[model samples]
Target: MKVIAVANQKGGCGKTTTAINLAACLGKKEQRVLLLDLDPQGHCSLGFGVFNEDARDLYDVFTGEAVLEDIILPDVFTGVDVVPATKTLQAAENLPVRRDERDRLLAKYLMPIRDRYDYVVIDCPPSMGLLCFNALAAADLVLIPIEMSLFGMHGIDRMYDVVRELRERHGRDIPVRVLPTLVDSRTRLCRQFLREIGERFADDVLPVMVQFTVRLKEAARQGLPVIAFDPTSTVAVQYGRLANETMSMLQDDAATDGVGEPATGLPEATAAVQHNNPANEAVPVLQSHATPGGMEESRKRLGTMKRVFEEARSRLSRQGGLQKVVLRFYDFTGRDVKLAGSFNDWRPDQGVVTRTANGIVEKIVMLMPGTYQYRLVVDGLWQEDPSNPEQVSNYSGGYNSVLQVEEEHATEHA
Candidate 1:
């Protein structure tokens, strides 16, 4: 079985969410999946509505009080079995195993039942401890979920350093792929950060991005994967795409003898995987929905998402009386210019209106009297307003054009 460890030392990066949903989506593809919760917080089990204060966990397995299969919670979701975690699992970090063998303990235990499942998805803890080390040492692939923020991208260098160390010690290469989570595509800041990630990580970044939505929170509250809670939601579609991409990646790795180069694009076709289980059918996974012949399908699925975000922005904009503030760009005459700022919740398409004249572009936004931070999207790229001298740090190693509006002259151009 291929083991995918969803790992990140940073918290609030959607690490557990990716693990639970990815497992559920993989199970939907008719693959036998084992969801292993290694986090002491036990949030993965909690996400699945199976968190029990008293349960046989990985700690028991590590201590030799129980075997791996003995604690399996079978069929939590279709074709998915869960090895749930409790708070006591924290004790496993202090197990008295020899230093060299501690890191390989998980890999050793997984060997016996490796053939029973097609995949083992491990939800790692948020710290670089023995548990996290065990997960990484045992991982065939490390899926890192990066939240779209400055702090979210922090400590990733440290993670890569650890991965390099493990690779050298294990004498095998473990491929890593970054999945951008909680993406809000409508915002210039988010879009800019996404571009920055692409430039920085390049081929290591996956094509599929998980969009920010309240429905995911609701699903977690209801103890169900987004698929089971709302099968038709856009987030669900994204997770489904992630599963397809992951399978295609594993297939590619298998084809190359577990040392394939980083995937830059979707595979044109997939070869079916043969399983050891007699009853299990051969796996013929497809590329992510949007990357293949499903462009129109993706557009249809995202329609609801767009409408929901627009309606929410409309409601928020209506909360206070708005005054017109004209912003001028003298340099970009023929280029397409749009405005995104704090006044419109950073969404480029929300409250900003644009007009072009002789060698100048004017963007007018309606806002209540207050200070605002804004950016110009010139021909699909983000930059601070050159005409505006005032600026503030965006905390993502960049600056934002700052504007101050008062009730006395709210109608005047800045």
Candidate 2:
């Protein structure tokens, strides 16, 4: 089985989110997946609604109280089993072990269950502690989920160094792939950083990206993976692509293991650049990594990726120039709520409200720079936004919340 550890030192980069959903997506394809939660916060188990305060975790195994198989929660999600973690797992770092064996503890434990599943997806903690090292030491492939932001790239070089150290120490060549998460292609900053990430980590960047969407957050609150929550959602489709790409890379690695060749499934330095200066033009970022033979398939894959991106750009061109505007309502305890405004012809059916983890009801709508009037329909009662003080009197007795969106306010809260 191929063990993929979803790791990044950066927080809020969708590491756990990727782990949970990727495992679920892989399971959807009839692949047996074991999701191991190495995070002390136990967010992965929580995502699957399987968190138990009294259940035994990896902490018991580390201290010789239990074996790896004993802590497994079988069938948490279809075809996915979870080895849950708890806050107690953090204490395993302090276990006294020989210097040569500390990092390989997880690897040693995983030996017995290596062939039990088709894939093992690990949700790693954000810190570079013993837990993270143990995970990296055991990983066949390390998938780094990098957010498309300035600070998201921080400590990436250090992470690369850690991976190099593991390769040298363990005498195993573990491939690393960068997956850009929470990307909003419409924003100028997102597009710029996406291009920069592609150029900088060309050899490691994956072809697919997880676009910014509020539905992911909504899914988390509902304790389900994005695919299980809404299979037709864009993020769900993107994660499905990610699972396929990951399997391809792993298969290529297995096939080329004895030949001393790199996986050709991952295109080196080829990025589909989406630009708005020309208004809906897809540009290919050129690189010098092209080879004469065997790597020809990489070029074909890159061309196909560019064509797919171009089609996405064509779709975006129709609704391309709009900025994101988030309308928030608090203390909403209704079965359903929706936004009706002039932006969408004041149709409530077009905008469905989503509640976040913090219990804040929100509706994200795209609009051009202009002033528009909107109201919230909470279970059948029309009301103004409680958070926004700006309002104007409508023809009815109540007021309509006035939202003024500008180009400078291109902040996307999704």
Highest TM-score against the true fold, candidate:
2
Give one clash count per candidate, in the order shown. Answer: 0, 0
- What TM-score number comes out for model 1? 0.63
Task: Pull out the clashing pairs in model 2.
Answer: none
| Minimal lDDT window, size 10, model 1 | 278-287
Question: Which stretches of model 2 miss by more than 4 angstroms?
Answer: 255-414
What digit string (tens of lDDT, one per residue) describes model 1 on residues 1-414?
888999987666799999999999999999999999998788888899988979889999988999999999999998889999998987776667786686788888888887898889999876667788888888778899988753355557667878877676765667778889989878764675576566455456777779999999999999999999999998998888888878877766663222122234323222233212222222211112233336575465445434544554465457444566887778886788888865554677466777777877778876555456778888999888887786544423356777776764566554
**Candidate 2 lDDT over residue span 206-230, tens digit each:** 7778989999999988889999999
> Lowest-scoring 10 consecutive residues by lDDT in candidate 2?
272-281
- List the RMSD of every prediction in angstroms: 14.4, 16.6
| TM-score for each predicted model, relative to the true structure | 0.63, 0.64
lDDT of 2 at 364: 79
Number of the top lDDT candidate: 1
